[model samples]
Target: MKPFRRRSLLAAGFSAILSVQHVLAIQLDLQSTDSIKAAAKTLAGDMVSYYTGYRPGDVPGNLPSPYYWWEAGAMFGALVDYWYFTGDDTYNAITTQALLHQVGPDKDFMPPNQTKTEGNDDQAFWAMAALSAAENKFPDPPEDQPQWLALAQAVFNTQAARWDTTSCGGGLKWQIFAFNTGYNYKNTISNGCFFNMASRLAVYTGNQTYADWAVRMWDWCSAIGLRDAQYNFFDGSDDNLNCSQLDHIQWTYNAGTFLVGAANMYNFTGGSQEWADRLNGIIGNLKLFLKNNVVYEQACEPVGTCNVDQRSFKAYLARWMAATAVKAPFTYSLLKPILEASATAAAAVCTGGVNGTSCGLKWTEGTFDGSIGVGEQMSALEVIQSNLIDIVSGPVSQDSGGTSKGDPNAGTSSDIGPSDLNVGEVTTADKAGAAILTVLLIFFVAGGAWWMVT
Candidate 1:
């Protein structure tokens, strides 16, 4: 009886393991274009299912609660790539409408509704989406609507004006408005977005000035230790501490952001060794986020501590890595296999939810992690569609039959006046006067606080 029971227990355990291992339901034949497009289409459709932004009474460009505005912009950006790669026009109309509606009066991404909650990083995500549209030659808006390249330039101009030398020597603040919680923090994402846009714009317009800004932003980030000697990009630092120490938590999106920007610089410089070295430095350290060649959120995925935002980070990494391959073809051999492994793993976990294909956060497990949302879906869609990278047409520039228009000074308001703007030039007297004004302001604030206490 004891011998029979032991054999039965072993059989049951084997059967249980087999049952939990989900079959690969997403049929992706990487070798065949038809097969790849079909798989990506289904995944994109499934992703769009969670988006209620276009529904009656819902805001057009904003994802529902728990998902932030920046992500919705990102989703549209992914859909633009989807259309570019797969020729699927299913999501284009709504994508265009959402983008146009959110351009705000300044033509930058800072809509009035998001003023209280929007950070510099938040606005940059939207600008990046618009830039993607221009690069992909996504259909231009009707003649009256804001042009895609101009919108991106507007964001670049506004952010350039906000570069804060007051804290951490130099870097953009995390938040746009003073009342926001992270206003005092200088973050990699904000600065990286600026760098990314600058590099891409440099490539698109053949503009030396944009390239210079890209170099400046990269130098500033490295000097400040946001990027360490090992190429591990840390999160952000407290301006209160003068950025002496970083947050030290590495996020996949931060690394991805810098990687794509560096790749673009490589293309802009006609394959400069400096940018090539930077790219290698970044990818060398990126292995920490990959498990079995599959991309996962390193910081929070393992511990199951990823909040709503962190869950979607791998999507950016996957998409940007694909872009990096296009900008610098040498990276294709390195990034392609990783992208293929990740896409396959990402597709396998889509066996959850009522549709039997809701994506989960962890792609390495090959089974649904039981989580579902816009992030998971976006991650899946990006990795899966990105498999078509090598076959699709690469991005174009103004010199290469591109048609998107741009304005160098799109977002600068005339009302601010030249004297108030410190971006261009400042004499010694200007610095001395600013220092005196700052001292007087501090004294008055202290005096006001003392009076209130008394």
Candidate 2:
């Protein structure tokens, strides 16, 4: 069937799933995974519609003019989770193609075209997508293509090399190149991503080096006050000021990144109390983003000033927190109600847009706030599908059935393409088509052993 026809049918069929009283909203029966999957299918379909990158005359790894290259990476990551949780392969082919096409010459996601604007965080998001692919056991790429584990490790290796020690003691600068805006700042998202990636890599590959890097990043963040006494992770600090002052803005993704990273560390150390305290601290502080149990962009939602990028912050937090529940196990009870409430609110706000099911940025409103974008749709999709967290098995590692190959020295090469090109400019649009693991953990659940370790 044609795309429009499928959307129309899906929109028309929403009535059967929605509650009669809340007919204007997409109401989900959170207790039922089938109901959750149905809602997720609708949200994911709507979310992927915003992408034009896969079409003729478009860049394969990009969304459009307004959406940045990094978000496209993040969206694909969410879709990977969508497939993992719901068993929907609807978006897999396109997702695979998009991921492979953007691997760049070095396969570190530093595609030559994106070097102008790519930051540590931007590249890390794409690496996170590859990380998600490895963890979720998404179908591996063809033997000739870049494997998922290698791609993630390449990114880790390159970024690990970029961890600057000259300023603020140690941390990654916001941007990769000195000319890019925000280059003088060192942000939590950038370093938190590294920490998250490293912790998971350690769990997956059983590498002490990656775990050491994870601990170092966490300590640097804390020592520099990016993570405050209350464990509230602020935004970036100015390296020009010698890291004396922070941006003080608390974005959900910042906390979410560190949250999962801490969870993995907690799991990696065999449930150490130190990591547990850090996990609980971050989780407690995250309540600042919650309003009556639903997740909201507290930094910008109330002011009606959320920019395009800020709008998608909730998606990462929702997904990361859900991942934390699985990785840590102990946090499941604490995280569940918040996620469930947010998912319901997210669905309720899907009453907007042409199809009357497009999500909005503010879930606190309890109604569609007339906002719509890839971010809104993605936030809704992730939160809805994450309801499957408990039912579905958690991520896998090489010790388990994971099949993605790794390269410890992957991104250490000095042969990456030049860094002067336009952010999303694809030189040869003709060759667009292509194709595209963590850890062992042992948890004691109710006096019984929960074997997350393969």
Q: Which residue pairs collide in model 2, if any?
A: 134-437, 135-437, 141-436, 203-439
Error (Å) of candidate 1 at residue 281 is 0.9
Clashing pairs in 1: none
Q: What TM-score does each of the candidates earn?
A: 0.86, 0.87
* TM-score (C-alpha) between model 1 and the true structure: 0.86
Write candidate 1's Cα lDDT for 398-442 as tens digits. 899678888888987721222343343446786577667645743
lDDT of 2 by residue, 1-454 (tens): 9999999999878865554325645759998888999899888888988997665445566888688989999999999999999888998987887888788767889776665578889999999999999999999988888899999999999888887777899898888876577878899899999999999999899899999999999999999999988998899899999999989989999999999999999988999999999999998988799999999888889999999999999999999999999999999999999999999888878887767788888888877788999999999998889889888877999898788899999998843222421154233332232110001110122112111100
Stretches of candidate 2 exceeding 4 Å from the true structure: 1-24, 415-454
